[model samples]
Target: MAAENQHQVPPPPGLIASLAGLAKNCLHLLLSRLELAAIELTEVRDTLLQLSIVFAIAMLAAWFAIAFGTATLIYLCWEAMGWKILALLAGLFAVLAVALVLWGRSLVRQGKLGLSSTMAELKSDRDMLL
Candidate 1:
């Protein structure tokens, strides 16, 4: 009769304690998984940051190389070719510019230029604005 009464009563505190312990264990497992994920994410971010830094540095170095090469070429030409050659080159450049302008005018007369189409599109867009 006494054992039956005990069984009928609410289960002892031990079962409730065990349930709390199980909950804690589950929580700890979940937290550890989250920590692992965070660590991986941090590592990935660091790697990406490093790669971006390296790429920027490489671009900067390449730009420096290009600037140095252009300056060197100009210096060599000015020093070796003398001022007379430089003057002649400048005259040639002016002539080339004039020739290109005349050629462009001829092409416009032939209707080979796309500028009119572009200008029409621009005008249409401008009309829509008004």
Candidate 2:
């Protein structure tokens, strides 16, 4: 039986071809996934850029408005309350700034800027590999 099996044939060629095909398929899959990730990253970057521009413009406008409004308010109240209202408004602005900073820091800590979907897919791939 052993001699007959040896004389029949070796399967290296077919086995190698199968392995090569599988490897090619895997490479194609990986490249496709990478392309998808690149597209997603580009979209995220574009959205962030657009939002940053809008936010910057809005912030500039708001700053000018706030400056003028505050000046008017202080001038109008100067004869009655003097600097007391100005000090109170300044303190209130400082507190608001502090709160905004803390909230932004917390969002960063929570990974709000991360590529979450890509990270999740990569993690799943890693788990499958392991």
Q: Specify the highest-lDDT model's number.
A: 2
What C-alpha lDDT does candidate 2 achieve relative to the native structure?
A: 0.86
Instruction: Residues 3-102, candidate 1: write the lDDT tens digits.
Output: 8887886856788899999789768755765565566667667867997799799879986985687567567788677676557666866896799799
- What is the Cα-based lDDT of residue 86 in candidate 2? 89
Worst 10 residues of 1 by lDDT: 112-121
Q: How many residue-pair clashes does candidate 1 contain?
A: 0
- On a 0 to 100 scale, what is the lDDT of residue 116 in model 2? 81
Instruction: Show where candidate 2 strays beyond 4 Å.
Output: 1-15, 106-112
Alpha-carbon local distance difference test for all models? 0.70, 0.86
lDDT of 2 by residue, 28-124 (tens): 8689779878988898899889989998999999899889989999988999999898898899899989998999799779975677878788788
Alpha-carbon runs more than 4 Å astray in model 1:
1-15, 63-130
